[model samples]
Target: MRLRAMVHRHHVLGPGRVPALGFLALLATVLLAGCTSQGGAENSLARPLMQGSTAPRAMSPVERLANDLAMADVAFENGDAKALANHLQSVDLAGATPSDANGEAKLNAWRSSIAAAPPAMRGRVLGPAYLSGILAAGSRINTEQVLLGGKAVSIAAGTAPRDTLRLRIVRGDGKIVCEKSPAHARECRFVPTYTQRFRIELYNTGPEDARYHLVFD
Candidate 1:
């Protein structure tokens, strides 16, 4: 799949916040391992350009998260593993605070889709373990872990467009809130009312690496 259009936004100082405004369009093609990206291409796409500010402002927490998260989205969709890792190196894991032992969780999904392919391809799929959760700062897919993170994170597995991208979103410690399995049916997942840690596992249930563009907010 090819990302026909990607609008990269500027890190603007909004009314007490930073808002990420953009859109995505997908064009299916023979999956490319990754595409050649231009330097500073993302900066040029920033919309609602800004002018003058008296002081250089440090990014707000949400703004910072959005920034790193945005970069991660691009790198992942582009099928650039190293780029994905570098873009998210700044995100601290403090947000994943553990919930109470008795806390209750909620789950919601419009539909569910899991792929069913030949069993022979199983070896190609279950190959990586996102070692240090959230595709950690130094996580290496070639070694052991190659996990991706964000409000929405996906890693497509398979040579063909039949990407069996299995996703599992687990909350702080041992709490499993939402689980979406197989195929290009991207899981919209959940927006938990409570604050907690999230760990995602990408199982490649296809014959080769799957590739697809993701629209992450």
Candidate 2:
């Protein structure tokens, strides 16, 4: 029934009515989420929308961090070397600077362990479908950061509210390569063209202001 409804909507929102690009991107995301297996980390994150948008779904600290670490591991195994490389690049930890080699080694070890694991466990080790779905959805929503200078930048979007979003860039041997910002309050369209590993740090510039949630994808 749900499939039928989605198909009908797809047909109704034909090329003439729906723009080919963004709508197709969203549709692809939805399909990917639907097709992925459900359970554990992936299901926990991915099914939030499948279950319903109104209800809140969150992972426990242990679960969330574990998921993140697992993702970082899988990213490395799946030839997503660029993903970690991007994260490292974003951190600007090039050999030019002092750094944490231990952390870099740990990341490498994590990847190595996953790579050595049996093929059957690889997907779960990486993260379930839901995790990928959420990330994919977020990626489609446009995002932009205006470098404020010196490791600081002002993030603006079509609907990003007034707030200072925190950013975190991971590094490998002192270099950044990829980045991701946690979900925020506000809907916007800004695609990040740069490939690097970084995360967002959101803050309310307004004193005593109400909390806001940013939604993309």
Candidate 3:
């Protein structure tokens, strides 16, 4: 998916600025909680505005890195710094620690990329169909209600050398549609008769930690 200009803007009413900002902060906290919670089934089905092509090419290393940064920018612009930070913190740098120069460089680069965005564009409400987070070693499920009209969906996983990630997609009707156990990345094109809810289940079959990023475009 391409990184385009954000359409939704938050306007503050006079004398209600404090409350508005407070509400937004509260909402962010709640959303993050919901992301981490083993919440009940989600039922809303809203189509994603970003649609992927029929045949998407595999992203080059540089392109993939750029896309990850772009997704972080999207989360940041949408006022979801927690999500962006989570993505950065969960980045698997092949055992590089904070003291490691190479690891620090990559970390700093992620921070700088988000910081370099225009101030006015930071902290807006996030849109639908983009999810990113870290998954511990085990079976984990990340569910989202998305509008799917056969758009191409991309799943990217980052983990240690020995780690493995499996992705399973379940439709609204409780039917499994696609399943893939990939070393790092996977892409599939799916078409739904109409907009509906879908569940994305990720299994960390390996012995180490796993991080993933998903987008429908």
Candidate 4:
């Protein structure tokens, strides 16, 4: 199978007194691997845009993550509560202290900012895992089955610090379409041909406990 097209994007939280540099590095390593040459893109349609004098240079994964966090900080400082929430979520606090006093203060502040918003808005702003302090780590397995329906599919997965994650997709014909083993602090994405059934597998191989989230569309 060939990758026809692919896009990589992330929903990250603001850098609120958390050790963000380490997290940014982790995301950068993972997303950058997929961005560069993960799917054998010698003839792939989704190539990186050329940097010309008239065109702005592309931001590397690290730069992009840093920019997102910086923007989130700016939004928070400007009292753009919704914008802040849009950028800051539970994922951003993956390896940090979400139950400590400082963490609780930050969570409460965010909740108060959106307390008057509509119920749906509130739900979206503060995700179900907000302040829950759930961490991903150790060896774990998660399987998901999906129907391709002749449409292109993209799967992106990432783990926290000191975590390694691997993904494999098996087709209805018992064919392995895509596989990725992202070592510690790596993010991965894959695009596979349409198939009747796709069995997606996620594996954690890190010594320390880690958490991961997957985005499939």
- Top model by lDDT, which number? 3
Please estimate how well model 3 matches the true structure, expressed as its whole-model Cα lDDT: 0.52
Q: State, as a TM-score between 0 and 1, how close model 3 is to the true structure.
A: 0.42
C-alpha TM-score for every candidate: 0.26, 0.19, 0.42, 0.39
lDDT of 4 by residue, 1-217 (tens): 1332222211133344256788888899999898777566863545444432365666433223323333444555589877766655433432222424544565456556753532332323321121112234445454555655556555544334323666577776778777767622222334445546677666666666544434343
lDDT of 3 at 118: 24
- Model 2, range 1-217, lDDT digits (tens) per residue? 9999999988887765657788899999988776774445676887787867565666432223323433444455566765644432322221111124544464445445433432222222222111111121112322232322234222211112223332233232334333333333222223333433334333333333322222111
Which sections of candidate 2 miss by over 4 Å?
1-53, 85-106, 109-217
Q: Count the backbone clashes (under 3 Å) in each candidate.
A: 6, 47, 7, 7
Tens-place lDDT per residue, model 1, 45-116, is: 553254333576664333344344445445555666565555444332313111222111100000011122
Worst 10 residues of 1 by lDDT: 103-112
lDDT of each: 0.34, 0.36, 0.52, 0.48
Better of 1 and 2 by TM-score: 1
Q: Tell me the TM-score of model 4.
A: 0.39
Worst window of 10 by summed lDDT in candidate 2: 128-137
Order of candidate numbers by TM-score, starting with the best: 3, 4, 1, 2
Worst lDDT 10-window in candidate 3: 90-99
Candidate 2 yields a Cα-based lDDT of 0.36
